[model samples]
Target: MRRTTTGPRDLPPLGVQQAFRLPETADVVLPEGLRVVCLRSPSAPMIELVLRIPFLCATENDGATAEVLATTLLRGALGRGEEDVDTELARAGCSLGAVRRSDRIEISGSGPSAALETLVGVLADVLTGASHAGTEVDRARRRLAERLPLLRARPSTLAAEALRVHCRGDSPALRLIPAEAAVASVTADGVRALHRAAVVPAGAQLVLVGDLDPERTVALLAARLREWRSRRPVGTVVPRAPEHWQRPVRLVDRPGSVQSLIRLVSPAPARTDPRFAALSLANVVFGGSFSSRLLSNVRERGGYAYWAGSRFDDILEAMVIAVNADTATDTTVSAVAEIRAELRSMATKPVTDDELRVAGNYLLGASALAMSSQVGLATAVSTTIGFGLPPQWLESFSDEVRSVTGRQVRELAEEMFASATFTGVVLGDARLLAGPLGEHLDMVLA
Candidate 1:
C-alpha cells in the first residue's frame, strides 16, 4: 500500500504540465484495424479516454440493437461481471460511462493520472478483450427486465413514452425502451456480433487527455492496445429521413395529470453544415438559454409555464424545444397556442438589440465558464473530436454569437417555422378542454 501526503490518492509526484488544443492526433493504425486518435493533456493530474465510435442508429431496428449493446456493456467485459467492473472503477477513483443516443455510441472514462496505466489497461481490456462467460449476461437480463412494471406507475414517464412511440414511428429509440427486454434479446453471439459490426477499429477514437507525457502516454497505450483489433468496416448505413418528421401533434393523454409537459422537435442543420454557427446563435436568441424567447413569453408575461426554454441538440441533427410546468390541465390549450404564437413572433419580429446583446453575452460567458474546469476542458476537447469540430472552434463560438444581428435571428425563425417543418409533442391529458387542433397541426392521441 502507498501513502500519499496531500493528493487524493497520495500517489508519487507528477512530472509536467502541458496545455493542448486538438494537437495533431497520432493515428496509430493497429494491426487489427482500430484507429487510435490520441491527444495528450499533460498539464492536468488526470487522464481521460473516450473510446467513442461512430455507431449509427440508422434504422429503428439498428437503434434498438444499439440500446441493448449500451446497457449490457457494464454487465460484463473482460470476463468480469458488472459488479466487479463497477467496483474496480470505484477503487481506482475513476468513472466509466456508456451513452447510446439517437446519433452515436460514446464510451468514456477518467481517473488520476498516476493510474493512467491502470485506466488505459482496463479500458482496452473492456473494449477489446471483453467476455464474461454467460452468467453476467443472464443475471443482468433478469434484473433489467424486472424494472419494466415501474414505468407504468409514473405518469410523466408513461406520457413521454407514448409520445415517442407515436412520433418516432418505427425508430429504434422508441423500440429500445424498458431496457430489460432489449437485454434479454441480446445473446452472447448477438452481443459479440454487434460489437464486431459496430465497435470496430475505424469506429474507435481512443482520446487520451491528461498530465502524462504525450510521448509516454501514447507509448503506454501502444504497448497495451497493440494487439487489439477492429473487426469491421468504419461506417454503417445512415438512417433515412425520418418518416415521422411531420408526426401528428400528439397529446399523450395522461389522465389526472395537473401540468402539461410539451416538447416540440424539428429538423435542424446537420453537424457538417457551415451554417451551424448562425443557427447556434439563432437558437440562443430564440430559445437556447433560460432567458430565451419561449421562456419570456411562457413564463414571464403569459404566466403559463415556470420552466420554458429550447435548445439545439449539440449534435446539430435536430432542434428540440422542451417546456414543462404544473399548471391546470385546462390551461393546456392556451399554453400550446401561446407557444406556437411565440414561434411566429420570433420569426417575424426583429430581436431587440438588448435581447441580442444579453443572449450573446450569456453564450460567450457560459462558454468561458464551461471551459475553465479540468473536466469541462476535457469534455470540450472530447466533444470537438466526437462531433467533428476544428481545434479553434471554441474560440469562434463567442464571435459568432456576438455577430448575430436581430436580422439573422428573424430570418432563422421564419425559416424554421414553415408549415410541416416542425412537429409538436405534448404530454398531457389531451381530452381536457380541447379545441380544433388537428385543423392546423397534425394531431395524434397517444
Candidate 2:
C-alpha cells in the first residue's frame, strides 16, 4: 500500500527498540606509550585500522610544512619506492591512505583479516622510515601552492576561514588553511624535520575493528611498534574561543558575484555534557536537517536560498554549531533575517512533541547506520575515544537522545541560540548589501 505522510511526525513509529551494544574490545598501552584499541567483530573476514597521530605545532605557519609531510609520508619509506609500497599493500589485499587534519594526521587502512600483520608492518615502516624525499616534497609543495589560492578564493572557504579567525585567533591549532606563500616556502628538509618531531607514537592512538582476536592484535601492535619510541609526547595546545567579535557579523565584498555565502557559528557544549543530546536535537529541529526550520523557512518556502542548513563541528577541546546558506545575492538580507527568525523561534517557542520525536528518531537511526560496517564501526570507536569518551559511550548515547523532552530542547535552544552568540562573515556584493544588512545585523565591511 502507498503511504501518505505530511511530515516526519506523521511517519510510523520505529517499533520495539533493540538495546544497542558494542563488541568486546581490548584497550592496551604499549611500553612505547602508544595506545591501541582493538575490537573483535567477526561479521566479515576483514580488518580496518585507524591511526591518529597528534600533529600540533607551535605556530600556524607550520601548517604548510605539515601538509607537505602528510603528502609524502607514504610516498617512499624505508628504502621502498612508492610503487614497491603499493605492490606490497596490493599483495596483502590492503588499501592505505592519509590526510592531514588541523590537530592530527590520520592514517587509515583496511585489509583481509589474515593480512593484519603485514599491514601493521607497512604502517610501522611509514612511521619510522618515511623518506620525505626531495622530489616528493617539492612536488607536493608545488601542488599545494597552486591549489591553495583557488581554495582561498572559494566563497565557502572564505566564510569558514573568517569564522575561525573571528572566533578563535589564528593559531596553529585552529588555523584551517595555510597561506599560499607558506606552502610555496615548504622544503624537503623542513618536511622531514616536522615529521620527525610530530609523528611520534607517544601520544598517538590506534584503533582496529574486524575479525581479529583482541589479545593477539594487541600483541602484534606491541611487537611491531617496539622501535617506534619517543622521549616526549606530542605537543598539544587548545585555542580559546573569544567571547565576542569586534562586530557581530563581518561582511566581505565579492564584487559582481551573483551569490552570497552566509555562515553563523556559536560555541556548543562538549560531547560529555549531560545536556549535549538535547542541544544536538535542538540543532536538528532548527537547521541541521533538510526538514529543519531554517531550511524549510528560507529554501523550501521562502525561496531565499537553494542551500541552507546547520551542523555541529568538533575542534581540539571544544565544539561549535554552525549554520550556512548560499543564496542569490539579492536575497542575502532576507536569508539572514529568516535565519535569525528561525533561531528566535526555536528558542522562544517550545518544540512540538512531533518535532522532538522526529529529530530523536533520526539521530538514533544515523547512529545505527554508522556502526553497521567494519569501516564505520572502526571510525565510531576511533571518534568516541578521540573525544575522551568511554568505549561503550555509544551504547548509552541512544538512550540520552531518547530521553530528551521537548521542553528540554526548547530551554537548551533558548540558552544557546537566543542571543548574539553567532559571529560570521557574509560574502556578497557590498553595494547591494551594505544598506539593508547594516540595518538587519551589526555588520562591518571587511
Worst 10 residues of 2 by lDDT: 239-248
Candidate 1 segments exceeding 4 Å error = 1-43, 56-92, 152-168, 173-183, 233-238, 242-247, 314-328, 417-420, 433-442
Off by over 4 Å in 2: 1-13, 233-238, 245-247
* Candidate 2: residue 409 lDDT (0-100): 90
Candidate 2: deviation at residue 34, Å? 1.9
Cα RMSDs of all predictions? Answer: 8.7, 3.1
Candidate number with greatest lDDT:
2
Each candidate structure's TM-score, on Cα atoms with residue i matched to residue i, is 0.79, 0.93
Clashing pairs in 1: 4-10, 18-43, 34-201, 41-210, 60-172, 78-130, 249-442
Relative to the true structure, candidate 2 has a C-alpha RMSD (angstroms) of 3.1
TM-score of 2: 0.93
The global C-alpha lDDT for each of the candidates, from Candidate 1 onward, is 0.62, 0.85
lDDT of 1 by residue, 170-209 (tens): 4444443545445457565665667667766564556666
lDDT by residue for model 2 (89-156), tens: 99999988988987789999999999998899999999988998999998998988888878877888
